[model samples]
Structures are given as C-alpha cells and as structure tokens.
Target: MVLYADPRRLRVSAVAEEVANGCAELAKTFRGPGAFARGDQLVRASLSIVSNIAEACGRGTVPDFRRFLLHARGSTQEVLAQLRLVKPTTEEDRRLVRSLQSRTVLVLKMLNRLYGHPPPDR
Candidate 1:
C-alpha cells in the first residue's frame, strides 16, 4: 500500500546519489590493516542513510516512514564518527571527507524538517 506520488521520493534519491559519491571517494583511500574494516563500515553506513530514506518514503505508513528516517539519521551520525576516525594523510582525502561531512549535515537538516519530531519510541 504505497503511493508512487510524493515529492520526497525525488529528494531522497538525490541525497542518496550524493552519499554514494562520497562513499566512493572514501573507498579509494581505504588501505592498510584496520583501515579496510573501518572503511567498509563507514561506506555501508553512509549509503544506508540515503537508502533507508527512500525505502521509508515508499513504505506508506506514517509511523514506519518516521522510524526509517530515524534509522537514516543514526546512520548519518555513524558515518560522521567514522570519518573522524579516519586519519587522512593526503590533502585530497581530507577535502573529500569534509565535503562528505557537509553534505551529510545538510541531508540531516532536511530530514528533520521534513519529518519534524517523531514519537518517543522513534
């Protein structure tokens, strides 16, 4: 029981695309022992943020959509933390991380405004 007609659908897709690009950049610098696992986690979590948004938007239930958006927000926070943990040696890597971080913050703000404050459990 989902509606195919919502403006938020397009917005979520665009946000996800941005996140995917950011994750791709991060994946390039992910070498070394511990860097592999950390990078993988970061990439997945970052991608999850955008994916969840889309899925939730299509779920058709108000509460379910809000719950998924909450999950997306949590994933965004996790990506930020992971980005902080990555000690980038190259200037390019630093720049990419900063860009990704900025984009994520913007997405979070948009999500908050779109959904407002959910219930206590969410």
Candidate 2:
C-alpha cells in the first residue's frame, strides 16, 4: 500500500509550526503591563517564519525558494533572540525556551542544506 503524506507536513512546515506553538506558549507566561507588546513581537516573528517557508515552497523557481528560505531562516534567528529577553522563572519555562531554540537551529540547518549552503558557524 502506498501512503501519501500531506505536503503541509513537510519538515520545514513542521518546524515552523513548532516555533509558532512555542511562541504562543511563552506568551502565555507573561504577566506585566508591558508583556503584551513584547509577546506580540515574538508571536509575529515566529509566525513570519512559518509563512515565509510556505511561500518559499510555493515559489516557481529554486532561486526564489532559496531567497524566501533565507528570509525564514532570519526570522527563526530573530525569534530566538526575542525569546532570550523573556525571564523564565520556572524550570518548565526554561525547558520550553530551550526546546524552541533547538528546533530553530535544526530548521536553520535544514534550510541551509536545501539551498546548498553550508550551515553558518556559531
């Protein structure tokens, strides 16, 4: 039997979804007056990664796709930087942020590989 996987379930999509969910989860932990604004920025950047990847995949040519993937990779890095500004008091919160960071790195690596570019040195 031939099994077909949903195109939306591609590796980039899955990673983007995970990043979105992680941002949402992190936003829920904010409580102060300025929290909402900061959280919104984080959410927007995280969601951009998802949309950019989808757009890249739909583009007609390899170069176009690579350009958008680079944008998506930049957004991933942006989200990671935003996440660092949040002070997670609990172990659970710390773990969640760490997980998101790890996933972002993985996605960046995947995008670089797809574009035939070497992963950036840390």
RMSD in angstroms, all models?
A: 4.5, 6.7
Residue-wise C-alpha lDDT for candidate 2, range 26-111, written one tens digit per residue:
99898788999989999999999888878776666666667888898898889888988888889999999889888878887877
Kindly list the per-residue Cα lDDT of model 1 for residues 1-122, writing each as its tens digit: 43332435456558756876788678778888887788789889978887887777667667787788889888888887887788778999888888887887887787787567432232
lDDT of each: 0.74, 0.79
Clash number for each model: 0, 0
CA deviation > 4 Å runs, candidate 2: 1-9, 117-122
Best by lDDT: 2
Model 1 TM-score, all chains together: 0.82
Off by over 4 Å in 1: 1-9, 117-122
